[model samples]
Target: MKTIHLGVFEVAGPQVGGTLSWPHPRSRSAQFHDLDHWVHIAQVLDRAGFDFLFFADGYGYPSVAGDLPETAARGGINFPSLDPAVLIPALARETERLGFVVTSSTGLDHPVQTARRFASLDHFTRGRVGWNIVTGASQNTVAELFGHTTMQAHDARYDQADEYLDLALRLWQTSWDDDAVRADAAAGVYADRSGLHRVEFAGEHFRSSGYFTVDPSPQRVPVLFQAGTSGRGREYAARNAECVFVQGTTVAHTAANVADIRAQAAQQGRDPASVRIMVGLTVTVRPTHDEAARLRAEFEEMQTDETVATLYAGNTGIDLLALDPERSLEQLLDRDDRGPVGQMGQSNIDRFLPKDGSAAPTVRQILDDLKGKGTRGFQVWGDPVEVADELEHLMDAVDLDGFLIEPIFDPADLEDVAELLVPELRRRGRMPQEPVAASTLRERLIGADGYFRRPEPAAASAHREP
Candidate 1:
């Protein structure tokens, strides 16, 4: 079996994103812009041997209730959303091995700029960079800002994304031969004009004339990541994603997702094993079970049910606040299947305890679960050994490549895991004592060691310019 890779998802706040169970009215009490915390966390992850730090992004805050804009802004609910790419350069300066992966929506950004930015970061990070691709999900937000009237249909968005990827690949891979740049100060020449080629692309969604603004970085194209299990989404991942992030509530559900993507990869003539599937998990680990429980309870008390409902409303595009308290998810699903909240209901109803034994969990339960001090992803609370056992169980049950671990409250969460849990995992033969090697992100993850090498300088042509 291949060594399992690990990653952590960053949800910038005092606590994880999602709902809280605390009863007191919530406020913007948490400090959001402590760059020190981010830098410290990046160093910890590098020291802990994590594969990457993945940041999930959205273009706009949740807009559901008539008072959403004000409510979200005032409450600091994902309000200080900063560009993740900007943070990577700082993080890259602090750590050597940990990779940086960030989400950028194709729908919201121009392909030329997006392509150049990632390439620049890859160079800055020395190949430890990845891109998580997403299409814009909120139309109201886009319409308000960019003059768009609406979001594209679900399937149509994927269609446009396909063209966008094709254009990006042509610019990154085919635009210039590998040896285009030659920095020879003696001759006062930089590029070999013969080896450079321009890529002219025209499609329904985008048209770009490109000579890649940035030279090929350590890895010409950073590792690609996609998070979607829909039919169109799976097809997109197979052709593009090196690793796919899956969000589902159960091992069984995630296994099905992994199978679907692998099957899709095989159909595309790509090795099914080439695509690595990682499930989301939030762990609260300690020295003893009792201590873990107490910590969890504290988190629970700080969260509120209303917060959960508000968040659910924004995610599903259904105002859970408007529905009757006793309404079943069966009722909601019957009305619409256009968004993620509905899909979460169908995909994860069994993992949660139903409020009245007829539908989804109550807003209170959602808050309670989310607010638990060491909660997020798939919650498993225990001692180091216990946590290791659970990790093994998840890896086996879900057939996962590894986990996208979310720190309960801070980066210290990862530090504890590394100190307490990593040793136990190594003793059990689940993880390696020494890292494989420091190489390109693809080499590190895919075992494609010899596949990548620095390109030789392109030959300078001495042509008659007279």
Candidate 2:
């Protein structure tokens, strides 16, 4: 049987699942700025044998609903977000085993800088770093932060990302030879000059001509993670990502995504099994089924309709406030007056739409469905054994590698999973009872065999001595 991997999903902000999550009495999100809060969570996950701590990030607040930022501000929806890159090293220092995956947009940062930053992080974490590649999905992100009057066309953004990744890969994989650094005290020499090569790359979106400043860390390159589920996105990920993050509203939807990604990977000359598929999963576990149900109900009650609308608007770039609540999604799609569907929005429709594409869910119904549910991932609630059973069933049904656990409340929600659910999973032999340490994040996630190995430099040809 294939071993299952587990990771915790988090964001450096006031709320994770929904707008009202931060205000809950048990929520520790208010301490987001405090290093101790992050350290405690990191330590908890590390001790629980989690494979990694995945941090989702964004550049701008959601403003798609009525083109007003006040809704997001009032609801505290993804506002006050901090850069995850700055926090990763601190978290890495606090935990010995947990890996860190930070989001960086291919559309925003230059490839060279991105390559250098992650390379440094790889060294700092001793190879416990991964990059979650995103093509800036929100128009607000491009307009407010990138100074673009309009968001790049969806396919165009992916086209740019394709080149961006190609340039980054060359910098990480080809710039330094394995034997580049040779410290010799007698000769007072630090590096073998011939072993270092300058990467000269020219692409439609990027150009770089330099050697990588940082030497190769334990992993050479951080594990690549891609969450895009569009046709272009899937192709890009299949060619590059070692781990793919996917979200779906149902089991069939998610399983289909997994199969598509694996098949695409095979087409790219990569072993389909070499790429791991992690589906998003939200859980509310208590000692008894009744207690769990009550907790879920309480969380749901905290959600407001406006908050849900604002959150969805921010994601899909469709102004929910402007649309009639009674209008069906099918009707909205038919109307040309509706604005362009953002990349994230398009992905959401693909995941949540009825299998036959005939159901017409109204705006009110959509918001009602999303209310109290913190994320798009599948939700599970019950006692430890029941939760484990659900997870195992999903795994068997979907062929998922593992799950990215979405936390409703910072440490408290995670605490329940660690204390209650984890033991149940261990008992079933679905997860390891003890934590296993690996030298690099790639080794931990996919093992050494799956890691990309750099080819050794060829020896100089023999010649007659002059």
Candidate 3:
């Protein structure tokens, strides 16, 4: 019965999940590098009352067991991406109250660089920025790109990620005090030297002994987001993230995940209710039910089984191409001693692999129900009213905070939602009547009662180990 929160999942590539919408006549995904395409989408969402736009980035492309496919380029799958961070200032210039969440990995990027970039983004976006902290994905492929002689163990990466976040926190939360700036032209004093403290963190994977380069921006730290369903990932998100994302296969499963994360947050010395939970959602809306169904049919035609295979193999590092169709997902996970999946990892494996006494889903299931019935999360296809109805029901069903809209087409699917779905949601009192303006992205997006208040973390010096 609370007002529903919302965000759109984005990437700087033509592909998202297994959907081939970029090839569609109406899709603008092919022009991904163009600011015009992004600006248009950002403006549309800003007008509609969307809270934030999240870019899911990664350093690696799909390569199963170190096998590079020549077809990757031809397929135009999840490849050939521009770094999404570069577009934030432009989008911020175009819209107000639309926060930006950029994904950066601890394994692939140094903590200092991550801290500096996000601080700059916070300043550029006027406090409308978030960081989706991920360990890394596509281990073998990314390792090759970074010239890692051997891949770090999955849990070990999480261990290192723990320290990485602390280091970044020192820069964001402790390096510069809120009143560090003293802009008094008469005295020629711009900053107080006493307020700037040097960060002296020496973790296993990183070390920093200098003062944080940037001054504190609004919110001090960008809103923290985490999107991993693995056990270690759940603990990591619970302990650190203000916003958590889940890709649910069923209504019951996602609800359980929500409860689990909240419970873990409580155990981790944080408020259970303050960990905002968002599920991935794929919406297909039209003026009529028949039109919606027809549109959905077309989407299914575009989202081929091979595409799902690519998505699965890339995220889980399990090569569906080389495996027997009948093999269980657990069997594949068992074979990989290094734990192929970590943060931003293995949604399908967690969904399809049977933990109950039931038979495990075969690798072939990724085509059937895994990637079937549309893209990830709770899916709906109908008129505006019908779509809105299902969304409300699901929100209550799971005690959800928001949904990450995964557009099947770049701007077209989002256009349909903005044009058709938002008005109905507003009419039903599930959305604000006016655009949310002059609010910090933290307060407007993830920081509130229904959406969970963004907690102010203590200064990083307090976290130093004795």
TM-score of each: 0.86, 0.94, 0.93
Query: Which stretches in model 2 have alpha-carbon errors above 4 Å?
Result: 334-337, 352-357, 450-466
**lDDT (10s digit) by residue, model 1, range 149-183:** 65556667777887777767666766556787889
TM-score between model 3 and native: 0.93
What is the C-alpha local distance difference test score of candidate 3?
0.79
Q: Looking at model 1, which ten-residue stretch has the lowest summed lDDT?
A: 457-466
Task: Give the 10-residue window scoring lowest on summed lDDT in candidate 3.
Answer: 449-458
TM-score of 2: 0.94
Clashing residue pair totals per candidate (backbone < 3 A): 8, 0, 0
Better of 2 and 3 by TM-score: 2
* Residue 217 lDDT, candidate 2, scale 0-100: 80
lDDT of 2 by residue, 225-260 (tens): 999887788888888899998875778777877888
What are the root-mean-square deviations of the candidates from the true structure over C-alphas? 5.9, 3.9, 3.1
Q: What ranking of all candidate models by TM-score puts the best one first?
A: 2, 3, 1
Candidate 3 deviant stretches above 4 angstroms: 333-344, 372-375, 448-466
